[model samples]
Target: MAARSALAILAALSLAIGGCASQEQPATQPSPGGSATSGTTIKEGLKIAFLPKQVNNPYFDTSDNKGGKPAVEEFKGAYSQTGPSEASPSAQVSYINTLSQQGTDVIVVSANDKDAICGALTEARQAGAKVVTYDSDTNPTCRDLFINQASAEGIAASQIKLISDAVGPDGGEIAILSATANATNQNAWIEMMKTELGKPEYAKLKLVTTVYGDDDDQKSFQEAQGLLASYPNLKGIISPTTVGVAAAARYLSGSEYKGKVQLTGLGTPNQMRAYVKDDTVKSFALWNPADLGYLAAYAGAALASGLITGKEGETFTAGKLGEYTVGKDGTVLLGDPFVFDKGNIDTFDF
Candidate 1:
């Protein structure tokens, strides 16, 4: 009966986690400010800069360079990417201030902390720059629009499903190796994961603990090591961040726990292919980071062009990806996450 219920949950999630359509879904909460407009010309040579959680990070590198940069080029805008080397709350504040002072037309950011960057973002807005937060969000009032990779509920359910499947029906102890504890997206998903775990179907699975790696490679590797040492009976691990999942995979791939413990979470194809091939990881999931950046760039362009305000019911077309609508609280859903394993991992390059 437990097995049946678990499979039922997976079946339902399989239906829910499919790709988001190019049309608008219904809005739940209304946006705080801004009025909608039909369309406008995207100004050429507009100065648009991306400030990621940190500079030189693989995930951000792809999102900003491969995704955001090309979109900026497509729109004929002046693009610049800059941020701190560390993923700290205040690390991005100074960069935000710098971009604002440069009189940038649009500032794209993936905030490290939800509130830490709000004041700076507000100031940027006051200086006539449109603020768009992508990947990770700040408070709703802080930005013009938020480009979310996937819905929080969808992500939470999918991660739980992956770990549950990897650990088998007779689930035992599990732990979460996540990015920084203060990460807005990470915390939102973690809370929903806990809610999912509370269901009777998952009673056999106990979440032993959650450890933060601060999104640092070495620190994530050490956190993975510590989880195993601290909990000998840990049956699986769910790492919701790309850096955390990749670092944990590296640690587990070389250790005695290679095949003994299951690992799954958000990871790029290039990073998790080896682990999937070697069986260190059963499966994992993530949306295309490049596409995320691409969409963000278009959204920023729309805001700067007055094509759409951050208001709900507003729609804009992203190049090559199609149209999307602004959802409640100034949010736009990119799409659902795609899971990767040995079968399909080879087909993906990034």
Candidate 2:
């Protein structure tokens, strides 16, 4: 059944991206009260802010359309999408200040720097705007709720497994290619991967090195080349950052190591499609970013409308999406990370 699902995904991708056909959105019912929960209503024209790590990245762009825009439209609330051209905390801070001045009822953000944005987020909260972090998170104390894509353990373990499978049972040297050194999510996942790699079950896998790319495509490409030169026996490269994975794949595809080395990590299907189709990368993983955006939008709106308060251990329904129990730390896990390979990579559009 899984294999069949994967084949269907690939077929859909072929049709969508290969220009074989146009894509369509799935029809979904509107949530009760025209929102996720009952008794929550925005002032006919309330405004909410949807900010991401950067603009123009397919990942965040899809989030805007599938996540924030739809929620605002459904509630008849005004929605604005803004962020830095680059994924920088200073840029995000600027936007947050602007949004606060604009009197946004809620601010939903995918933070660029974990701790640096806390001050700004606190200010926004103080100004009566409910704050929620998604895609990435800020300090739990500073934000009302964090909508996590998956648990740190799940993300780390999956990457380790992908590397182990690529290297086979012989247990060869493996290295990591990551984004900026300060990226909170990437650092947490790397730590988790290290822990998983040391377990007895993964005795055959040896992690040799880790390199940072600062999420720059050119820099990531150069880093990939450097890793190949530095680790002559490196069997696989696990890149947890989308930029790193795509850069590594692009580098390997044109180099002698194309099939000699294995590549796997968090990458968008569109960006990594060529590498996957050419067999340069075996597989990668990501959740539906659109769904992530959608959930974040709902959470932001719910918090603002008083339909649901951002209390730890609180349970509430997110309109038509169903019920969600807030964890002890005010964090909400959307679910596990979805693995994508040749089998199912084609089915998803974003």
Candidate 1 residue-wise lDDT, 1-350, digit = tens:
01123334333233222322223222112222346443455667889899999998888888888778877887788989999998999989999999999999999999999999999999999999999999999999999999998889989999999999999999999999989989999999999999999988898999999999999999999999999999999999999999999999999999999989999999988899999999999999987787788789888988888777888877777866666788899899987777888887776666
Give candidate 2 regions above 4 Å deviation: 1-44
Model 1: how far residue 164 lies from native, Å: 0.6
Model 1 residue 160 lDDT?
96
lDDT per residue for candidate 2 within 246-300, as digits (tens), equals 9999999999998889999998888888899899988888765765676677677
Clashing pairs in 2: 6-343, 6-344, 9-346, 9-347, 10-346, 13-346, 36-319, 67-294
Q: Identify the candidate with maximal lDDT.
A: 1
Give stretches of model 1 more than 4 Å off: 1-39
Error of 2 at 47 (Å): 1.6
Model 1: per-residue Cα lDDT at residue 97: 95
TM-score of 2: 0.87
Cα deviation at 246, candidate 2, in Å, is: 0.9
TM-scores, each model vs. reference: 0.90, 0.87
